[model samples]
Target chain A: MTEKGSAFLDLMGGEVFRDGSQGVKIRLTIEPHHTNPRGVMHGGVVASLLDEAAALAIKELLGLRPQDSGPHLLVEMNVSFLAAARPGDTLEAEASVLRMGRRVAFAEAQVHRGKTLIAKGRFTFVMQHD
Target chain B: MTENLSQLGIKGEAARSPFSGFIGNVLEERRPGYSRLSLKIEARHLDSSGRLHPGVLATMMDSALGAALRDVRRKDEEGIPGGTVAMDMMVLQVVREGEELVAEGRLLRRHGALAFGEAEVKKRGDGTLVACAYFVFAIGRGSPR
Candidate 1:
């Protein structure tokens, strides 16, 4: 796996890795600050991880760096939460691009803890070129 | 109108999710089937492109909707526990750091243990719609986790 880095990914404390294929994976350890009142991982954190994973996958598929491309805007996303993640649990999200067009892209991502699927998401992004 | 979390009868620590606190979302109002929250875009909330990250908007939407549901549920006679099941969101516009955005959530309906809600995010001053979302929540699930 090859490591990739970004400012938002770093702020979220997730480590991104390319699986030598079209897929990208992001792993994050749940922290106290990541939890909701019920002490489970916040839904927002889950969504953020899924979004980042899918965005990275799209970036890798296009082979475009941030500077090399125009603005990449997330146009739509649908997410389903299947289970709850608690503090101390390490969650990993894997994503891959489903389709790529001249100005748009589609992707899907699943977040898991071990073998348990915690959440899944589908994303659409509008890509621009300079 | 700005309101304190405590004024909404939400216990500070119990109602304030750590992640929400980390992001600095302030509760603006809460009533039966409705809630509003505001966030100030900061450097940390922006992506490499200097625009507010969509994920940050998602977080706010989820929290705002959940708060709306929670408020209504607590007023219910049963007071069942619930959690978010699914959400669909569309981002129509983007904001930059130093801007303030407000999210308003409203419970649309409830059937048995299922509740549906919608949220809209807008620029605080001009009320320009930034994003909108629909959410599904499962009540009596004994906590979302």
Candidate 2:
């Protein structure tokens, strides 16, 4: 595990899964802040989790550095909400790189509540070099 | 025939595109390259940090860009059409929850088969800049094809 993964785990209070290419898996509890009037988790909350999963996966791919000399910025993304998660349910977001080019990288993520897929999306990021 | 796109999940009022039965709402038919919207943040859109969820920011910008693309393309077409696909995007800043947010999206430039646009999100109360995003949408002939 990279230091960045460990740090992110500590920050989010979730364990980092062991996987090739540093794919991240974090289980999040759907709290009141994440629920909707229907008592299900808000779609926006799922989006945030997907975003975090993509961003951290990029950081892990780059290697664990104390200072970020080159920053990664998202250029575009399209997400689909397929299911709803309720409060108290444990949701997990998993992210991985679909393709990494010299200037841009493609990442895909799926947010799940146990075995049910709540949302998934593709993200394009521009890598800034120092 | 005039149909409201919001009703079909094409637009949302301060949230996902909420389709109302009302006919010909001006917000849905905004021009391509120039789409604007304002909404007062409510309790339903905040995160644990009491800030506007990034997903909301993403959705708002995506809607604005999608509107611009829809307007711009239909203006040139000869027949009834559908919608575009948002291929990718990035949110640059965190939006504060409960602040009235003003969103503006402009068609930046276009590459063949792909259109690029930028959206700026700002706080309505103090006008403090919030999040900005760039999106690339795939253009097509008609409704979400």
Candidate 3:
């Protein structure tokens, strides 16, 4: 499945792809606007990508459609920046669900530039049901 | 020296980073060990459900934390050179569009080639805490200005 129509995601220009029973992947090309003063991708952008990927993984794990389910609130997130990604680089963020409970879910994601790991994140989300 | 610090503000040419500018982060104040910034929620800052996006909050917190460290280091005769290595953030309340939020960051400590900081995001009107975050940064030697 391909995710679309999120204003914030559109602003970031990420392409989402879901693999059957595996997880979700978000692909983004580093633009000049994404760079920080050091001319590399901003750490916050990396964190955002990690968070989104992880959240999407949880959504897939529960088999909930975006429109049908209630909003999933991100309770906590931890990100570790391993390396810097420069402009013009293509980074792919892949995520998987670690555990899913009745109301809370745990997921993790890693951003990579080919073999180079750029960042990783773990997320805790409160899954609301309608 | 003060001019350089002022350049980090919204009216100055140096302002924040490109990403910060793109996200409409406005630097309100910066001083030793502390920094303040604000952002007005827009349509582009919301998720599909019309709620404030977590990524936007993370961006604000990350920028505020880094700015606090940068403010403190600006006083050194050398220059400021560093980057965020890790961050942990928790959302205390959910925000929505049209809410203006302010983030205040405080540098907690600096050790050998490392710095620690924390930040709080609050609603501009009622000062309700929206989020809190902690950051770890690696300090280096370079010409920041």
Taken over the whole model, the C-alpha lDDT of each candidate is 0.78, 0.56, 0.79
All candidates: interface RMSD: 2.7, 10.1, 2.3
Runs in model 3 with CA error above 4 Å?
A18-21, A65-70, B1-14, B74-81, B141-145
**Could you report the DockQ of all the candidates, in the order they appear?**
0.59, 0.14, 0.64
Worst window of 10 by summed lDDT in candidate 2 chain A: A2-11
Tens digits of per-residue lDDT, candidate 3, B21-63, equal 7888887777777877888999899866678888899888887
Q: Write the per-residue lDDT of candidate 1 for residues B41-129, one digit (tens) a residue.
A: 88888765667777888888888887777655533524454567899999999798899999999999876677889999999999999
Better of 1 and 3 by TM-score: 3
Q: Which lDDT tens digits does candidate 2 get at residues A1-130? A: 4323322223233344544634556567765444432345544455556765776567667783322323556656677666767657888788888877788888888888778887888887777666
Model 1 Cα shift for residue A72 (angstroms): 2.2
Can you write out model 2's per-residue Cα lDDT over B42-131, one digit (the tens) per residue? 544543334444556665665566556655554444233222333244555555545677677789876555577888778766777777
Which number leads on TM-score? 3
Q: Higher TM-score: candidate 2 or 3?
A: 3
lDDT of model 1, residue B122 = 98
Q: Against the hidden reference, what TM-scores do the models get?
A: 0.87, 0.50, 0.88
- What are the per-model C-alpha RMSD values against the true structure? 3.9, 10.2, 3.7
